[model samples]
Target: MDRANIIHDLLDWIETHLDQPLLLDNVAAKSGYSKWHLQRMFRSTTGHALGSYIRERRLSQAAQALRSTPRSILDIALQFHFDSQPSFSRAFKKQFGKTPAVYRRTPAQGMTEASPQSSAQQPNYHNESPNLHLLYNGKCTDGKCTQWMGQR
Candidate 1:
């Protein structure tokens, strides 16, 4: 397939797997490309790193959940694979210039894009604590977050 087609397929795959842990190695394997090649191609085509694209999409979905549902910020953050509320808030504020709580309260003042559907309709992803810690925070560290070690 062409580069554009490959990128499109990659994006579609990402969207479908938004609720799951999206590791770079896993994505590379799924796309049948080496991690380096996939990163280079994705960046060249999308003007953003693959990791950045995934992070942005996850944050966008979390924003939707924040605004459209009564779910707690922590639940929304965890649902989108964020390690903690603080880290999620930092990224959310960086991206939308407002915290999730603030955005939920006044969505119009933040990014105004419409969500594809209500977050309520999404399946309950009852992921284990270990998996959540590994995917979101990197290390367990006695199950106490001493610092924001995950991606911003």
Candidate 2:
């Protein structure tokens, strides 16, 4: 298959399997490519390291869980495969600009309420090539906050 098609399939697989251990070796095996080659293709295609994308995706899901679930921060962190709460907090803060606890306690600006349904839905991701930037602007519309994916 072509590189674009291969990358698309890889992205889908990664999304579905986010809850599992997704090491570079594991993903490379799944992609039927050497780790080095897969990394090159992934970076050239997505403009981000394969590992970074996976980590960001996990962080994104963890953010949703934090917003909607009564689950503890540590539980959420563990669920997303972070090694520890402190590590999870560091990554979460780096990505979302708030520690998970603070993030849960303070509703996002312009967002008045959290819906359980939103937590069940997947975060918005597209199949386009090139880099993406997740804009968690907390801009609410019709009582729902939206996260936007933009070209980098």
Candidate 3:
């Protein structure tokens, strides 16, 4: 694939796996490229480092979830692979200039709510699935666990 196609595929993969614990190695493996090469190409094509792109995307998704879902801030933070609520809040404020709670209370004008069909299309993490594993403190715990994991 060409550079643009590769980058597009990488982005799609990132979007599909946002709810999971994404790591550079995993992304590289999925893309069939070495980590260093993928990082360089991703940065050149997207004008952001691979890690930054992932972080920004996660924050964007978290922002959307904050506006659309009734889930708690900490739950949302953990769902997005953030280490803690404070760290998530710091990053959210840095990106959106408001905390998650404030954003949930008074979302910006352009914030769009996901339609029922779109929401229904999302994967249900609570469902029993062997391929999906919940990680806590770097260890895969029970499938039903929702404890905090370290940074992605």
Candidate 4:
């Protein structure tokens, strides 16, 4: 097909096969484009370049491992085909602000928290006028903005 379609297919293939080593030649052959040509097109169209996209995808997987899996950093790195934990950590930090361990410390990290079950629990939305939108700087219950609107 076209160049963009080829690259998108290649990216999808790479993401689906993240646990394996993704080599340039292998990718080139898969997309029926030579290494140099595909690399150039991939860099231009995606704005990320091939290597960055793979590393970013790996880092995202590593982050999920940090959150959901009991595997250690080294184990996760090895699983993602990174040579060492340090390399994985460096790449992870580059992609996301925090290190894997820091992101995993959920209660202390505050990355996730209890959800607000209803509109009453949140100060941003109101219960009485359900589904209403308000832009008040002060507490919303006062109806001060409504009064101001009426006067004008």
lDDT of each: 0.66, 0.70, 0.65, 0.57
Sort order, TM-score high to low = 2, 1, 3, 4
Candidate 1 vs 4: which has more lDDT: 1
**Which prediction has more favorable lDDT, 2 or 4?**
2
TM-scores of all models? 0.73, 0.76, 0.71, 0.67
Candidate maximizing TM-score: 2
Model 4 score (lDDT): 0.57
Q: Write the per-residue lDDT of candidate 4 for residues 1-92, one digit (tens) a residue.
A: 55555655675577567789888898888878888887887776554467765665566666667777788889989999998888877776
Per-residue alpha-carbon lDDT of model 3 for 8-116, expressed as tens digits? 6676577778889999999999999999998987776654578966776677778778877899999999999999999999988886667889878984565333211
Candidate No. with top lDDT = 2
After TM-score superposition, the amount by which residue 81's alpha carbon in candidate 1 deviates from its true location, in angstroms, is 0.5
What is the number of backbone collisions in each predicted candidate, taken in the order shown?
A: 0, 0, 0, 0
Clashes of 4: 0
Clashes of 2: 0
lDDT of 2 by residue, 63-152 (tens): 778887899999999998999999999987786667888878985676422221233334335221124454432233332233344665
Q: Is candidate 2 or candidate 3 better by TM-score?
A: 2
TM-score of 2: 0.76
Ranking by lDDT: 2, 1, 3, 4
Q: Spell out the clash pairs found in candidate 2.
A: none
Worst-scoring 10-residue span by lDDT in model 2: 112-121
Selected candidate, larger TM-score, 3 vs 4:
3
